[model samples]
Target: MGYLRLLRQRPILVLWSSAALSVLGDRLYGLAIMWVVYEATGSAVWMGIAAVVESLPYILIGTFGRGLIARFSSFGALGWLDAGRAVVACAVPLLWSPGQGGITVLLVLVLLLGTLGVLFDPNLGGLVPDLVRPDRVREVTALLDLTNRIAVIAGPGCVGLILMVVSEVQLFAIDGVTFIVSAAAMWWLRAHTHRVARAAAPGAVTAPARRAEPVAAWPVLRRHPDVAVAVGLHGIGFFVAAVSAVGLPTLLAVRLGQGAAGYGLALSAVGAGALAGNLLIGNLRAGRWLTVYCSAWTVTGLALIGYSTAPTLPVVLGVGFAAGLAAPAAAVTLRTKLAGFVPAQRLRLITVDQTVIRTAGTVGMLTLPVAVDAAPATTFAGAGLLLIAAAATAAATGRRVTAAAIMSSREPAGSQTS
Candidate 1:
């Protein structure tokens, strides 16, 4: 009650609640959709294709999506985008089969879902700090991380239980309703309007109004060496996760003959471990970005290689726990970097750039089936090698660059106070 009273100074609770609701539904539908596709066709290749379709849109609209967030109201853009996701999620069941029409429809829907997701994150990334106390950013981020892990843990298990009775279509429809409910909540959230400044002074110059504010994000990033390095390292780190996240699930369920329930159960271990790590070790004042970030990613890569050879449920579950714990810690550090760089108004644009980086790793995931086919032993080994290289490069470059600037850096300046 006391914390709620403090947070009540802004509508951070209401907005974050809406986020939790929508993301929970989104994750549930995602697990259901992936398993349903694998079930219908029994094809690992299509699973990879579906994963590609989902991430490819962010690659395509990476810049344009950022521009939209920067140009419009974050609340308005994200609310409508979440509503739009509800519409597309409903159509997922219609493409459950693996025939020509089924694959095409499913791929199309994946594209739509991914595009909407690209729009969703940037707007929301810019929105969150607006609602919370600035000093509480690490706290809010940790809570949000915890919330998302809870969703991942709970959601797949829910789908596993539901799959015993209802069809995937029913699950998809239920997810749609959840999104609609979430969007309604978001629409009602009392966020500080971006246009308030323009309204107050009528002379405020927005990002778009400034002719010098360019669209090329690479240059924007270059001005801040540490931030650019961090973002780039995030892109590389995602490759390791892609293989583990996308490849392992398919390998377990579709290739190994463990049903979707088995796959979800193993993944839930990941969510559970991540929830524990973030809650326990990822305190704002305790984390050592250089040491923790480097060692964690190295260990995560090794775990992925070990997972490729996991023969039993116990091994996979153990690997999942390690990977999940390390991955989120790394992600938290990158997000902290994001908070320090760009202005609050343009953070949306930067998030779009982040989406692009993740998509690059998805491209690696898309190639997994081909690699698996070529040399089963070699593929996993290659992923491990790449992971080490990426972590090494980032530690050598980004960590060193930022260490000197740590004391001086702060979250972006904005119209509103923390």
Candidate 2:
């Protein structure tokens, strides 16, 4: 069958579509939340507090949510989480009122949203390997990343036009509707999978049994030391990328003396570059992944440094585009490798991988002010150098892992699991 035919027949397309919808709704809902909170509290401090409330849970989940993720299969975890988020999104607009108490309610809803997100994001990624054939994993991942980037680009671009047509409440109500679509898609995928599994095992009294003694997240990390090191380096890369995402606009607006237009241009350049990079990466073979990841990170760091030292807006924009281009190589390679390394049987690692990188990114974002206070250029240089080092470490350890695998068998790393 053609790739397009395979895509249409798989639940992965449903998963991909739902993720895009969720992202769009999330972007719009975030804008609505900020506006409502600011209008109610009239204090930037309260807004800051709201932001913290929203972010803290993800960090907590990254550290602790792995065991919880292991309790249910990835699909079960994902479908239920989507359903819960849909409920909260719908309730936000329905239950909201304009008062101090309304601000309190918003805070609660944001916390719930974050909590659901903590479980949903990782588990959803974890589910991909199980749902699709091993050969298609990389392709599915690339497609999913492509969908997410499209949503990220469209979400922010459309927010202004969307807000012009509807009140904050009305916008959130629409956001709720998207969540409902996402939830429904997930449930449908679940039912379809169950049916397929049943058909595959005709006359069997029951479906395949769940793992009787599921291992914990830390042990899985311990077992795969190379993956652990790679994951750590990946987390650092994430941190640098997250910090840059916030820092670039400030550099453009405050330090470079360019206004909103420059910041917007730089941001769009990053997204566009990332989209292009994903397309480029899809063509590369699996054996070349380690090289691609290392080179991408190393160059991305250099690009970030270039952006920091650039004298003109155009130069900054170009450098930002370069950084974006390199960013996804690490993401695609590491994610595809990790999915293969830790199969559906050892599901704990999915949550562990997602949570670690997410928490690290959040920390990087939160540390921005400190970096800025010390020196903006110095911060960029530090982050860039860290990424270069991470790439080197990943390459070194990845070799050891590959060598070990080769000694053990003729099978390639991709064939060892899943």
Candidate 3:
């Protein structure tokens, strides 16, 4: 009911619609390109290269390009980026050939799309708080997360049906159309709303003069230690998640003697759990965000540990479902907390968060495979234990920070009478 109420508002409706379309399109594009690349090359190595090339931009841009991203954290700029992606998506089929030259061109296009994505993703996170009433930020965030979960669940199936009737290349064209539609919706929002502009305007009181200067995220994060802790823990969580991503299938094969079908069921369970979590969070009023965030990670860690000991497919699915359920609570709360910062610092902080997550995931992907191969169950349990420890540390640190701040506030201003 709450999600339905939020969806009725025109701006929220438009924004949600665009997000749904764009995210689904992204899924289509990603699967299509990977399929096309592997088909053309018949090499897993090329597929791996393509995946790395696509993910590398997030790390690069998030680490070094925060200021540039801040400057373009506007609806119009975001719309243009979507438009650019549409062109790039459409060009893949038109320009690609069946040789190494074509594969090279496809990788280049993928890289370009990824770069644009890095620019667009954090800015969108920063934009959501500007688009809605402050009380509804969490709800909108949940809605967005829900959209992504739905896309993850349905995108592949949709692609499967499409591939039965059309070539993989045509999926890019459909993805292109979705981007164009999203761009149009964004531009409409730009024409209708002034909150973001007013908040960012130089003369506005909320937009401090200091905001014009490029503020580094580190100093800003240092000033807000809780957010810093959340960001750190989020990275650790992603690292653990990457380990599970690689280990889960292997576990299913060796332990349960299952293959793709089991893996698919596990994924669907997670998606279903995530969808339920989003709906629950979206309907409820906001609570202590940091506590919810930490607790979610703790539960996630427990779920990972559960995965290691799951003896049957049903048990594995249950563990997967629990992990998925916790993910959205952690993610939505973290974003809701990040929304509390000023626009300039908010975008930069989000960029830093994204950078940390992407970097951790990349490292996990590269370094965890051998460990996973040697000991899948141990890897799962170990990663789970590490995540739980990180969550506890973050919670303890947050408590100390809160206590110190309170004590400082209570102290006399001029107590040194001597």
Candidate 4:
């Protein structure tokens, strides 16, 4: 069958569509967010805080929620979370009145929005294998990567234009409506019956027997050393991701004096770069060289940090694109590896792994603004340090992970018994 026929057979395309919808809102939210905060408080500090609130908390949330999701059906949990995100995304745009327009309100709204995000991501990832064929996981992930790239490029651009034309309320309302579409699409997904990839290992798990979910990240990861290392290495990419997403843009606009548009342009470059990366980079034939992926993002963060001092749009985009390229490749690699290491039953926890990867990025988001605001030009150097730390930690230990994978291919132990 053709690839299009494969997409017709599964929920992945639909789920991927849902992701694209949310990402459009996600980008719009980014544009709207910067505009509202920058225009409202007139402080880059507020912008910093808003970014932090949106991205930072996921680390602990995913780290802890990994347990909670393990208990419920990943699909059920995701559906409810998707519903909640839609409600919140809808409500946030309405949170404005002359008297109510305080930094406090924006901060509160961001907090609420961030809280919902914590639940949404992992559950979404958990749905993938349940949706697509095993052999095609990487291809599907790459496609999703491409979808996100488009969203990143389009979100801010559309929102930026909307801000020029309409009121914040209307832009926000549109964003909310997009969320409604995204959530509704997710609801249409057949959660219970999506096909799983790992159903055929020797003593492979049968559908009926492996229903009891494992609760903690450690338990599942402990047995799967390979995946655990992949998660850590993925965190390197995440660390760089945070830097590019939060640290560089703020530094460019505030310290470099390029303003919000500069920041947006720089990010769009990263998105464009990532789209290019997905197209150009593939083939898990040398998958064990996970360090190469870590190095890619580390270079991204470091280069971006250095680019912070440069006063050119093209320079910013160039650096951002390199980072972007590394980011998605890292993501594609880790997700593909996770599919190999995990069972059908542990999809949610695996999703949590993806979430936690970004959660690490969130940690960077939390600190980056303050660092940029306080030190101005030098904060990016701090980002470089963060990226390097993540890279070195992962690189030093990734071989152990590769070894485990080698062992798994020899004999898959986590295979479920029917």
Candidate 5:
């Protein structure tokens, strides 16, 4: 289904709008908070600490709090969480001061918001499947991905525009307002969904069976080896891609003698590429999703290597665009497959996948910056090679798993000794 038609459905429209606004708010808050921290402390070290703190919640929640996500996988709970985040975000400007004590409070608030985010994300993922037809899940996923890309491109620009007229501290208040609007929309959606469920004929729709015992994502992953391979490759890709967070700016400064304008252009290229890629994949009807997923990463790896070799700004932009183009295919493919799982298992696995990716990214961010600065081209090439190798491993493993399944199916009923 086309995005417009699908979005015309009130539930999908509300959900998409809420998500878009939330993401934009997140982007604005991230930039604003970082600016505030640096301005108040004038320390790069403190900024780095704040970055690490922001990522810690994802690892912590995804590891130990998966059950929390499962338990609160409802619109009402999600709405409240957004509302809570709003309060936390707005507190930053009001509570902060100019000394160490103020920075400590700011860090705590950042952690609180991040924790709420870690819970909010997987629950929202689980909720999406219930709102769309089975076959149209991929389309909805693409649409959501598109929202993220637009936010990536536009959010910082929006912040820049806002800063021209208002103080950086006020951005937090604006972000809080966005969250409040999102919460209101979600509450309305919850009421609408409940009404539709009640109005449906008794036997018209069957609900997913609830499991008495919560299933761990690892066991389910073992049962689906192909998904396991895709997820593993995804983690590696994330780890390698983290280089860009530091590497891109370094590259533009060292090699091209360009600063903020060059960096912004490169980022814009990436966002535009991702937007196009999502649209392309969403419209296609394809099989062998595992192959497509691996291929996307392979292309991404190639783009990274290309970035290393590029000696000009234009080349960097082109390579960044290519890398962005391939990203959504990998993400959307994995999400579409996960959506096919039983609802209970699906939520856990999504959480696990997110944890793995976040953990890998955090590690990469900590470890790769020095190498990127020392030898930017060599480091990019090395990371690209590792990414390609990871993609190859996933593809080969998927093929073996597929062959084994086919051979087992071909065996006679009596020949199968359980």
Candidate 6:
């Protein structure tokens, strides 16, 4: 009853529901675009170029967009972003034909979407602390992660069914509708909620203004070495994830002698496992977070090694599941630690921190191709060993601020003591 009661609260419910729908739409849109591109162009090179264009905004805008986000009302910014994306998604199908420079048009649209997404992302991260009670941040973060995992697991199957009955253009129409719904939900949440003072008196003292000189992110991170280390550990986890994502199909096709079905199953297993992991992490108290964080990576590293050597589809699936289970602990713990370590005043910097983490995944993915020429087993094993080292590094750094200490500093006002 209590959990359901919490879920019924308008802001939380609307934000979470909208996020889930948005993620599902993104998955569907991505699949449709890739399929359409390949079908129309009949060239893998074009697909690669599309992928690079899609990724450029994160790399470019993520570095420069934080200041712009910090200047606006995060909730309003997020709503406008959703609205803008909805417009773009709707316009995409109207502007394209198979042979008339469709690839160029797709690339431009993808770039625009990525730019909007980059601008939206940090503001969204900045909004979380304001939206929920201090103690609920970790749980909310984990829940968000769970929604994404669910989308990843179910999106392909949903796409398969949709494609059986509708054109890709029609499926994109559905995607546009999802964004419109998400934008509506965001607007509703904004209308119903205040960033601060849900229950304060009309004449309560307002907080002091931020400094004229913006707080430098690098200095703040330098002062909190633990935060930096935790971020790096998070990045390492992401790196492993990126590598596996790129490498799994190769392993299935070349080593295990399976095809698309096998790859899909393996991916499904990973997503399911990640969902389970996030559920477990969400319910866990702070006292156990560090232990879980360290152990999860250790297990994930071992799972990667296991996956590398798996001789059959079942074994590979099992290994993928195990790795998935371990993945969320590192992510959730690190994020929780961040919420504990970073002061409310500096919380906007979280976007920058997260940008680095995402970049780490890109770095891992880029490096993976270099090793693709090596045996699959050898490449995976090496990646596993690097993650194991990352686990050890996280544990070593974690001793500086125990989870108990983090729990004690959960207050929203001055949580930066970590």
Q: Highest TM-score, which number?
A: 5
**Model 2 bad stretches (over 4 Å):** 1-5, 42-45, 74-77, 206-213, 286-288, 342-346, 397-418
lDDT minimum window of 10 residues, candidate 1: 206-215
RMSD (Å) of each candidate, 1 decimal? 7.0, 4.8, 3.5, 6.5, 2.7, 5.2
TM-score, candidate 1, is 0.77
Looking at model 6, which ten-residue stretch has the lowest summed lDDT?
A: 206-215
For residues 1-418, could you state the per-residue lDDT of candidate 4 as single tens digits? 2235545755766666767777777777776777777777677767767777776556556555555555444554556666676666667656664333556776777777777676665555555654666877777766676677777677656766877888765565666777677766665663334333243444655453233354556656666665676666666556545555555656776656778678777777778888877765543443454666666657765775757666677777787778777767777777666665455435655666656566666666666556666765666666677767777777666666657666767876678658
In the range 1-418, model 5's lDDT, one tens digit per residue, is: 4898888998888888988888888888878888889999898778878888988999998999867777667788788998998999888889988788989999999899889989888878877888889989999988888888888788877878888998988888889999998889878977887778767855466454342235688777766888888888988998888787789888788878989999999999999899888888888876799989999999999998998888899998899889888988888989999999878788888888999999988888888888998998888889999999999989998889867866766888888475
Q: Candidate 1, which segments miss by more than 4 Å at Cα?
A: 1-10, 35-43, 91-99, 191-215, 246-268, 281-284, 287-291, 305-319, 342-349, 373-378, 399-418
Question: What lDDT tens digits, residue by residue, belong to model 6 across residues 226-308?
Answer: 66666667778777676676777887788878888899899888888898877778887756555667788889889888988
lDDT of each: 0.66, 0.74, 0.85, 0.64, 0.85, 0.73
Among the numbered candidates, top lDDT falls to 5
Better of 3 and 6 by lDDT: 3
Per-residue lDDT tens digits for candidate 1, residues 287-317, read: 5565566667787778768767787888888
Per-model TM-score, in order, reads 0.77, 0.87, 0.92, 0.76, 0.94, 0.86
Score candidate 4 by lDDT.
0.64
Arrange candidates by lDDT, descending. 5, 3, 2, 6, 1, 4
What is the Cα-based lDDT of residue 140 in candidate 5? Answer: 93
Query: Where does candidate 4 clash, by residue pair?
Result: 205-416, 206-418
Indicate whether candidate 1 or candidate 2 has the larger lDDT: 2
RMSD of 4: 6.5
Question: Any residue pairs clashing in model 6, and if so which?
Answer: none
Task: Please tell me which model should have the higher lDDT, number 1 or number 6.
Answer: 6
Weakest 10 consecutive residues of candidate 4 by summed lDDT: 190-199
The residue ranges of model 3 lying beyond 4 angstroms of the native Cα positions read: 194-214, 405-418
Q: Given candidate 5, what's the lDDT at residue 409?
A: 65
